[model samples]
Every structure is written in C-alpha cells, then in structure tokens.
Target: MVRAGFYLLAIMGFSVSGALGADAVERAVASCWACHGAGAAPKDPTMPIIQGQQAAYLEKQLDAFRSGKREDQIMSSMAESIPARENARAAAMIAALAWPKVAGAATAPAPDSAIACQSCHGADFTGGPGPEGVAPRLAGQFAQYLEARMGAFSRGEIASAATMTAMMKALDADERAKLAKYLSGL
Candidate 1:
C-alpha cells in the first residue's frame, strides 16, 4: 500500500540521483541512510548504528567488506557500491553525522568482565583508541546487534580482530548477553 509506494519512491529517487551525477561517495552514504536511518536510530534492532562511529573503525569495516574479509552479502554489495578510492571519504562522512539518542531499557550494573572491555571501548563505553586499533562505541548501540556481533566474534566469523575473537571465545553466550544488555542501556 502506502509503505510500498514510499519504498518505490525511495528506490527511484536513488536511481535518479545517481543518474543525475551524484558522486559515488554521496550515493554510497545515501544508501546507508536507507537502512541506517537519517540522523536517527535504525528501525531494526539487529542493525548497528553507524552514525558518529569512529571514522577509522568505519573505514576499516568498509575495507573488510569490500575485500571479502567480512561476510554479509548485503553489506558486501553496499561497501562495493562506494568506489574503492572513496571508502575513507564515505566513512568520514558517515562518522561526521550525529549519533542518534535512543532511549531503551534501564541501565544495569556493569559485569565484572566488562572492565576488560573498558580499556579499549572507553570507561564510558563510548569507544576510544585501543592497543589493537580504534574500538567502536558500544554505549547506546542496539543490544541485538551487540549480542550478534559478540557471537560472531566468538565463533570466529568476524575476522577483523583476533583479540576480540579470543576474548569473546572466553565468555559463554550468557556472559555475552549480559554484556550486550549492559552496554546497550548506556
């Protein structure tokens, strides 16, 4: 009905914009807003909030997706949609947008194991430089996305961080869930 029409309009708009000579980086970022939401939280709980994420982290992920190191079919395509030379520019653009202020469940007390994460993710869980590299912000991220990523790391499905893989593998699923819940409420 109306929802379907909106989608059609959006798709057509994208096509028209590209055909009208919108640059690759602008097109790539516009496509991100389709799923990631424009300056707001995504509707799907499983999708991560990319706005205001560390530019370095975003750039690394885009490269990983483009190189086949990361394995989401849709993301692979999205990453590829950006010209290889414009990956950093696209990441910077996305990172420059404000992070959405999402209200959710109340914050819980931090798990003891969560301390280890603070060294990289910042004491506030807003993310910072780590020994490994730039850690992405965990505070206010979706619990479902966090939990899924933790599980992926545990299973060695995400190849970006061996440290994360080893750390996640040490924790049981329950522990990871607890961590995700705690982080999301911040």
Candidate 2:
C-alpha cells in the first residue's frame, strides 16, 4: 500500500508539472500572436511583420522593450507585462515559425538611397550581419508598416537613437515610401 501510494503521488506531481509547463508556453505564444497574427496587422503603414522573425532577435528586442531600453508604445506596453523567462520562451516559439515570402511588385530605390542602405540591410534589403547588436532583418515586412515606422522615427514618434533612425532622417519622404514599398515586396 505504501509503495503504491508513493507511485500515485509521483504520477500526480508529474502531471501537474506538465500541465503548468504547457500552460506557460501557451500563454506566452498567445500573447505574441495577439499582435503579430494576420488579424492584428495595424492599419498604419509602420508596423513590421513579426510573424516569422528570428527567435533570437525577437527575444533580444523583447528584452530590450521590457527593460525600458527600447522605445515604442505598443512594444513597451506588451513587453512590460511579460516575465523575462516567459519572454524567452515566446521568442523561441516565434523564431520557429517559417519565414513568409514577400508578395507583389518590387519598388526600386533611388540610386543614392540604395547605396546608403545596402551595407546593413543587404543588397536585397534582407537584413545582413553587422557588428554584434547592430541590425535587424528588414525584408518581408509590410510596406505600410515599414513606412509608418520610418515616418515615426523621422517625426520623433518612435524613440531610438539607433543608426536606423539616423538613416531614416537622411531620407526624404518619397525615399522612405519607396524603400518601404520595395522592402515589403522583397
């Protein structure tokens, strides 16, 4: 009887642990999909597609937002409520999703703008590596989303002194729109 009771208790304990783990993962994923899924695409032109981003990069950005180190109203609010460990789990899940191919006609950038952007965003505008912690992938983003974000930085709506912002400031409105359209179709 004693041995049987011990085994039963062990089983129950494991069951409870398993359930909790599953719940944690589910909650984290739901929170992320709430904003990133097709339904949540902000009507504005600036929100980037988060559907199939690199998990490591996503996790880093989430951490930055949570820590109040990154600036964006929506991201800050969302990240603020997530615990660090859970954020990491969410990031992993997002990263696991397959990247979507960009659709529609590709817009071309002016030669000057193309030269300025090619170094970090890649010749194709798919993001490439730079010094550690320097760049994020820009390809496959929605044009409206990209445009809105660049406009925000240009208007001081989003707050990051990062090189991207500097680059944004250099572009005229037409260039920004062209790049956004071009990237979305990549």
Candidate 3:
C-alpha cells in the first residue's frame, strides 16, 4: 500500500525529496545490490550485470521469477519479498544505469558455432532484436560465466528461456566453450 501510494505521489509531482527523488524506492531495492554488487558491476562473474539492461527485459525476468515461471530459488525468494507493484519501479531504476564494460578484454574471431548467435546477439555480439525478445550484450561478459550458463541451459537448470536451452543443447560442450570464449573476449 505504501509503495504504491508513494509512487502515486511521485507521479503526481509531489515527490518529497526532490524532483527526481527515489530514495525510498532505492532503499527498498538496496538488497539487490548485495549479490548484484554495490555498483553496476556484479561481484561474481556468474552474476549477470543487470545495469543498462532493457527495462522490458528486466521487468519480464523479474515477473517471471516472482510468478515461478522462472525457477531461481534465490531470485524467486527475493522477488516474492517485494510487493508485486514494486517490480516495475525496481526495473526502471536498474535499467536506467550504465552498462558495465570490461577494460582491455580479450577479443577473438567468431567461431563457426557462433554464426547463428549473431542473428540475435548482433553482429558485434553486443545484443540485438530477435523474434522472442531482446538479446543481452555478451561482448564484455566473462567466458567462464557464459560457459556455465550454457551448461545450465543444456542441463535444463535454467529453463526460463527455452530458446537458449535449445541453442545450447544443439552445440557440444567444446563448441559452447569456444563460442563463450569468443563472445566473452569481444
């Protein structure tokens, strides 16, 4: 009730703190920074950098976790704790930040296995439009993290996105690793 009311107040241009005040909402979202990191960068390579992600994508993923459509025990519990109405607010704040970049990241030529990925992930592998939804930028992400995620998709551990699972499963471990290495370096 309070969350919605506050948003309503902000929307009405009666924001208490300032013209763009969101201190209360930011406080509520503080827990997200625990695993995601104090800054836009994730502390762990395995953790996806949520900053600068498309707002629609973030909102969709959050809703999926909250609704159990996506099976992430950690994220599900976290999502549950937030009032349903706050999901949009949280997504908006996170998505508005800058995307993290890896300085001097290794770059490699795209392997044959990565050809199909470009159709969605973009020619630069930064991300692009697709039939399903917006693909995330994988250019500066960690190779180990990408490999692990591909492995999870192949094993159905991450079943929230079916296309990824299918694509990961189509390639053997070596191919996936090669693609991950190539994509991560860019």
Candidate 4:
C-alpha cells in the first residue's frame, strides 16, 4: 500500500511539473506573438518583423530594451513584463519562427538618400560586418522601431556621438520613411 501511494505521488508531481513548464513556454510565446505574429504584420509601419532574426541578437536587443538601454515606448513596455531568463527563451522562440516576405508595394529611396545611407548602413542595408562590435543587422527589423530610432536621432534624442545618430541626421523625413520601408522589407 505504501509503495502504491509513493508511485501515485510521483506521477502527480511529474504531471504538475510538466504543466508548469508548458505554461511558461506558452505565456512567453504569447507575449512575443503580440508584437511578432506567426504570419500577421505589425499594424504600425515602424515595428520590425522579429521572426527569423538571430537568437543571440534578439536576446541582446530584448535585454537592452528591458534594461532601458534601448529606448522605445512599445518595446520597453513589452520587455518590462518579461523576466530576464524568460526574455531569452522568448527571443529564441521568435528567432526560430520564419520571416514573412515583404508584402504590398516596395518603396525605394531617392538616389541621393540611398547613397548617403550606403556609406554606413551598407548598400544592402544588412548593416556592416563586425560580430565583435559595429552596426547591427537592420535587415527585416521592425519598421516602427527603426522609424522611432531615426526620429530620435533627427531630434537629437540620440546623441550625435553615436554613428547612427550622425547618419540619421542626414536624412529628411521623406528619406527616413523610405529607408524604414526599404529596410523592413529586407
């Protein structure tokens, strides 16, 4: 009888632990999908498509957003609710999802604007090389986030010392919009 009781208790314990783990993963994924849907595009033009991004890069960005090191109202707000370890797990999940192709019309920047951006952001806008340190992979980033950053740079919210800020200053509103659209499609 004691042996049977112990067996029952063990089974219950295993079931409870399994449920909790499943719940954690589900919650984490739901939180992320609120912004990055499996197939749905963001309502705002500024939000980037996080699906299919590098897990490490996504984790770093989430950490930055959570820490307030990267300032963006929506991202910061979303990151706030996620714990550090959970954020890493969520980022990994998002990174594993497939990226959707750019839908709708393709908007190209003016020749002059294109030239200006290529000087730093690269002709492809995949960002410059440097795993150790340098430009980030801007390709397929959330459009809203990119636009917000550009706007911040233009308004001097981002310091001029930052290379991004300097480049952003060179772009007018039209150019900024064009760049955001182009980069998001990548």
Candidate 5:
C-alpha cells in the first residue's frame, strides 16, 4: 500500500499541472524517456547508457554522428534529425542525471586491460580527464555493445579515435570480449 502511494506521489509530480508548469530542461529530460528507457538506463544491450554521461562527451559524440565523422546508421540519422541548436541542451539534460545503480557491480573484477583504459576512462571508469577533456563512462556498459564498438574500431570501420583503434587492436578479439564483459557487469 505504501509503495503504491509512493508511486502515485511520484507520478503526480509529473502530472498535467506539473508538466504544464515545467521549464525547458524538464521537458528536454522527459524527451529521452522513450528509447533510452525510463531514465536513460537502456534495457537493450545495443543501446548505450546516457543517464550520467558527460555533457561534453555526449555533445561531441552527437556532433560526430551528425557530421558523419562517426558512422552509426541509427545515430547518424537520429543526430541529424535534431536541430543543431538543441544539441547542447539535450546533452546537458542527460548529463545532469545520476548514474544508475549497477547491481552485482561489487562482484565484478577489473580486466587486465582496465589499467590501460584508466588513462582515458578514469580509475572508476566513471569518466575523468582525457587529452580531449571528457571520456565516456564505461563502468556498466553492455558487453555486446562494447564488443561491437571495439571491433569496429579495430577493423577501422570506426576511426573517430585513433587511440581506441590501437587499444582495441592490442587487446585482440578475446581480450576485448573479456574487457567488455567485466566492464559491463559493473
């Protein structure tokens, strides 16, 4: 009974009155609830988590996709579909969100290649300083999603980051899988 009340209370905050009174940021944040899942923790393994991604990083990626610098059939079209003016607003909206909980994360071990990764992805893989500023967080990514991306980089299908290409190549397919598996579980 209490849980139901709590849910009702939460929903009420997003009710017509609340929504009608919301500012731009609130509306923008709500726009992502569809494909990215309710709060940006994607249920699909093919989707990347954007709930707590760095604003700059997300903006850069969006730009890359829009400009054809990064080639993802879905993202390229999606990025282009949005007006350039709204890019920063969307990124900021997503970035302001908290990182979702990673169940069983404590039981996950770091892969051998995680140290090399830390230079860019940070010690916690929750992002940190990079030569370019912000690096995307990879702590709880989906293995399949990570694997596909690493493979694309290794094969030169995606060359946005030369460093990532080199790293993926050095890891090889097996090591990449291991790294992805470990990181995703976190």
Candidate 6:
C-alpha cells in the first residue's frame, strides 16, 4: 500500500512539473508574437521575420542578446524575459513555425558579391550549417532590416559577429544595399 501511494505521488509530481514547464515556455514565447506577429509577418518592416529561422541560429542570437554581445535595447530586455533554461525550447518552437509569405519584388538576379554570402548562408540563402555556425535564413527577409543590420556590422556595432563585421566592412554602403535588396527578393 505504501509503495502504491508513493508511485501515485511520483506520477502526479511528474505531471505537474510537465504542465508547469509547458506554461513557462508559453509565457516565454508569448511576447514574441507581439512584435513577430501572430502567424504572419511583423507589422513593422524593420523587424526581421523569426518564424522558420534555424533553431540553432535563433538560440545563438538569444544567448547573444542575453549576454549583451548583441546590442539592442528591446531585444536585450525581451531576451531577459525568457529564462535561460527555456531559451532552447523557445527557439525550437519558433523555428518550427512556417516561414511567413512576404510580399516584395520578385527574385532578382544574384550579384557577384552574393557568392561570398552563399558560403555561409547556403547557396539559396535559406541558411544551413556553415563554417562559423548555423546561419540564419535571409531569403525573403525584410530589405530594410537587412540593410540596417549590414550597416551595423560594417560599423562594428554588433560585437558578437566578428566575421560579419569584417565582411560588411569590406563592402561599401551601396554594395551592402544591393546585397540586401537581392537577398530580400529571394
């Protein structure tokens, strides 16, 4: 009888903990929908679409934001809201979501400079395993957001991405803009 009671209590404990974990994960990702949109694209063109991004890339960015390696007031605070233990879970959840359709110019011819980007961001810029790590998908991302990020890298504002900083610095502003435009139309 004692063993039976103990087993029942153990099962109940596990069930409760599992439910709590689910709730915590939900809470952690709830804020993302505000800026990232419920199921579609973000309301602001400046916000990069996070849905369907590589889970590893998303997790890495979350860690960077939490550690201040990546600079962004809103992102820093938002990253903090997700408990460190749940970061990977949150990223996986987001990555599992379908990539939202973005209305934009049709796919443009790739510029010569784009060859360098393909080395890390995949041949199609849909992202995959790379020399540095898992690269985020740039295909169909916001042109404005990409240009701004590229500029920031060139200025060395994003201290977390040393390789990106060097590559961006090599390109002039016009070249960066062209690359961003081309990538966004993919």
* lDDT of each residue in 1-186, candidate 2, tens digit only: 999999999999999987887687677567765456543443334456665676666777888788777777888878766655777777767666666554443655453575676776667665646543435566768877778778888876555446677778888998898877767766
Per-residue lDDT over 1-186 for candidate 1, one digit per residue giving the tens place of the 0 to 100 score? 999999999999999976654476787789888788777899888778999999999999999989988878999999999987888888888888898977555687788899999888999988878998999999989989999999999999877778999999999999999999999899
- Cα lDDT tens digits, model 4, 20-47, are 8767766766876665655766655556
* Residues 1-186 of candidate 5: C-alpha lDDT, one tens digit per residue: 999999998898769654454444456556556667674467776877788888988988888989988877877867765566678877887788887754444335666778998888988888866974677888887778888988988887876677987888777798888888888887
lDDT of 2: 0.68
lDDT of candidate 3 over 142-177, digit per residue (tens): 788788878988988876667888988888999888
Who is ahead in TM-score, 1 or 5?
Answer: 1
- Between the candidate structures 1 and 6, which one is better when assessed by TM-score? 6
Which of the predicted structures, 1 or 2, would earn the higher TM-score when compared with the native?
A: 1
Q: Put the candidates in lDDT order, highest first.
A: 6, 1, 3, 5, 2, 4
Q: Report the number of the highest-lDDT candidate.
A: 6
**Who is ahead in lDDT, 1 or 4?**
1
Which digits, one per residue and each the tens of the lDDT, describe model 6 over residues 2-109? 999999999999999989888987897987989987888898988889999999999999999999888789999999988778889999999999988786556766
Candidate 5's error at 52, in angstroms?
0.6
lDDT of each: 0.88, 0.68, 0.77, 0.68, 0.77, 0.89
lDDT value, residue 87 of candidate 3:
80
Error of 1 at 159 (Å): 2.6
User: What lDDT is obtained when candidate 5 is compared to the true structure?
Assistant: 0.77
Better-scoring candidate (lDDT), 1 or 6: 6
Worst 10 residues of 6 by lDDT: 101-110
